[model samples]
Target chain A: MKHITDFTIVRREQLGQHYFALTLRHPGTLPSIAAGQFVEVEVMGTREVMLRRPISIHDVNPAENTLTLLIQVVGKGTRQLATLQEGDTLNLIYPLGHGFSVEGRNPLLVGGGAGIAPLLYLAKCYKAKGVETTILLGGRTKELIPVREAFEPYGKLLISTEDGSLGEKGMVTQHSLFSAAYDHICTCGPTPMMKAVGRYAVEKGVDCEVSLENMMACGIGACLCCVTDTDEGHKCVCKEGPVFDALKLKKWMGIE
Target chain B: MAKLETKIHNITLKNPVMTASGTFGYGEEFADFIDLTRLGGIIVKGTTGERRQGNAYPRMAETPSGMLNAVGLQNVGVENFCKQVYPRIKVIDTNILVNVSGSSIEEYCSVAEQINELPNIPGIELNISCPNVKKGGMGFGTNPEMAAQVVSEVRKVYGKTLIVKLTPNVTSIVDIAKAVEQAGADSVSLINTMLGMAIDVERQRPYLSTITGGLSGPCVKPVAVRMVWQVAHAVQIPVVGLGGISCANDALEFLMAGAKAIEVGTANFVDPTVTVKIVEGLQDYCQRHKIDDINDIIGII
Candidate 1:
């Protein structure tokens, strides 16, 4: 029932060997979307792929009516999504799932790899709301990072690469900027990385929230397929939250 | 407006579209999108005697037309569910079916017993098709004897409608359906996710953290419909068909295939408001065809 009216491929700039950023036209009246929210992009460019790919809303320009997506062609779906050109239409379910809650005045935005997409959006939103935002980005290399220029305007941007290719040649948490610089923390990325950030935030007595990437069939709560154990019980990432408070998440997800 | 009514088993659905368990998150989360009162019923997430943390990371992987998940029956246990979730959802107008999961017969009985005392719970759905867990889950449904045993034990303590959700991973769904029927199940729901796996060849590893996962979505539709047809012919109890049912036409396919009722599963993820849309679509289909009652089309084939 939810259909896309337009899918204008604004630009496609390759970030790494396989990763790219595909900025598209934002359709409909721009709803007040927050950081950590995602859009399900319909990638029907090829006969091989059918389902829509869930991509974090990397950045949005309400004035321009545009949304940017940082995609890594790790699979057939991404590869096909990458091949679409300008003026071509693609179906998209916009602003799905709950985004990061801007409860604290100062929150550390930690992200790695493709997970950085939502953090960038969060940083922009927080900055606009007059809240202090600090970001820590991590990847295998500097080339792996996407939309670095887009995040610079929001706040202080720190980077860590595994191969010492750029920024600080270490993990984002290992960087000196992570030493009790913020009152709270929010993160998204691989499970191990988020667990590390969550553990650090907990040890520091600061609240943290992590955006989870559980396998999802129906992004809604129906399938009961995406249940994640939490202090409250089984919670679906697509329904209850893709975002959870760090303390509550620690009790169930543990420290990886 | 117009009347939007449906019937499943002895229970009458305000509408034919009900949210599948695990997908709707105890039925409270979707209150923002659609009126839960308008729904036929809601199957809550799988509940057990003890808390479960579920499986490792990368619990989901997308396939060609569907996706796979190995979210091991992660739950807050029966006591917490009764204390926290049950109280809130009890006030909802729709019928609430608690999905009961356990690693053993005693566990199943224990949860069912607790659920029986709940305030507004109308039924209990035995999630015997969970492929992610090692102990109970699919282990119980794969074998006819084990499936029958669990059903029979839960039947003793659970006084409400008992619907045993059967797994599609088994070689013979009819045998298991028969076993649960004989074990005193009030009705049967099928087919749960099928066992499948996806590989990340470049990394030389599996896409899901659990390696193999349960598949669902449009890709599993034909297989699910076929199984529902086979089970309907073999069993005497009402059959609630589920699997990749996104639209009214898809639901009609199951009805014609002999499903007494159809449950919308993966479609909820594709569109949060899909249940409402499907209900309208079904009504429209019925009116156009001059079908007086929706139940008349059930098991038509």
Candidate 2:
């Protein structure tokens, strides 16, 4: 079941120039949140911003009853969220959309820019299951890949930056790990990068899932504004999935 | 408790708060956040004769106090609705109505006729005012005669309460409202989203794939209120007002302007529980004002 709750900001950390990881604790017991699910955060008391910002679930601590949101300031809603301080009240509708299926024996997790947010939680799930995981994170520069150290304990972490400011200077797809044999692949990032990963997965005959950050209105399925065309038809990214099998997405596999 | 009941033609609402079409989906989307039985009505997404894939992606854009959308009336057509949607939604306790849209007069009547057969559905909101579709939506609504013609045709096959939704993009909204009322509509709902567009200056391109879409939200409230007041006096039928209604104060503005009931539209996106909150607010308003029945305030202005 989904919930609309007023949570208090327990911690706020500025990881980079524009990235902030906010830890919010619900007053009540937190619902079970999956690895790839997200939340619609209400930007309280903002005059200009009308819609809530959808951010991926970066990490969750059930014992603390807290959820961590990894937000990048790209627009007014997110920029407003950056001003939030610890102890401030924030409202959220959470545990939304279908998350990634934790079923891979040896999984290759790929992330680009802000797309790296959800993978940390996914890697933790894979770690708990004793699944061998390899994560490749990419960004335009080193500053873009902010939370590299957080994923170190959960998996083998690899990094690539276009400016050669970090490990293995190149796009994530160019990383040496791409050539490795993996039973399953999951990625979230820029569309072009995910599509390239999807194409590679198809060629390798490996099951893959990509989380799409489509523009949305209501984080619920009511608005039908955030639909992505698929082999089945148009599916609401907020409802049916923000994470989908690479094969079902027409655009991802280069299908008509 | 203040009497919150209101009537539109033969259909009596438990309250005067109905979820607007398109914004409410099939009513199940909001069930997790709100009690489905507390609403006055649930107007499902636009239903047509056949499945419409709708327009291409990039169908929505956010503006200052509002948003623009060209969802193009995407739905599972009437056949699929009866088979797949109806059984699931029939369990929802409140009044369930379908916003019927089409690209042709025959298509409109066909969908309406099918919905009329459903035992649980008490009414159909004939959508001649939708500005998103290219063919039959706003085309029928902008012109008074076309609006009347479509309503009159749908009224023949649909026996239940018929509410014709109106468009505000026209020169005179009252003209279209009066025409629909004259053509056998039991009630008239105004106004659908206004025709509008936006450009992403950074990208130097149109924000929406359709280039133009329906504008809705708090910014459109004044225009909607003005239109509702104008049409409420011009026609004898009850007026169901909607367009940027987010709170009870906003709902009261419409009721005082002569709307018998109000539909909460874009506000649902900002707050999923807004409809029920508005319902509670209405009751609170009635108690605070010492008003016995909510109907006593209709058309007071």
lDDT (10s digit) by residue, model 1, range B75-142 = 78899999988778899998898889988889999999999998688788899989989898899999
Please state the error at residue B123 of candidate 1 in Å: 2.1
C-alpha positional error of residue A16 in candidate 1 after TM-score superposition, expressed in Å: 6.8
Name the top lDDT candidate: 2
Error of 1 at A42 (Å): 3.4
Runs with alpha carbons beyond 4 Å of true place in candidate 2 = none
Please give the lDDT score at residue B188 for candidate 2. Answer: 93
Task: State the DockQ, from 0 to 1, for candidate 2.
Answer: 0.83
Candidate DockQ values, in order, are: 0.37, 0.83
lDDT of each: 0.80, 0.92
Q: Best candidate, DockQ-wise? A: 2
Q: Can you list the residue pairs that collide in candidate 2? A: none
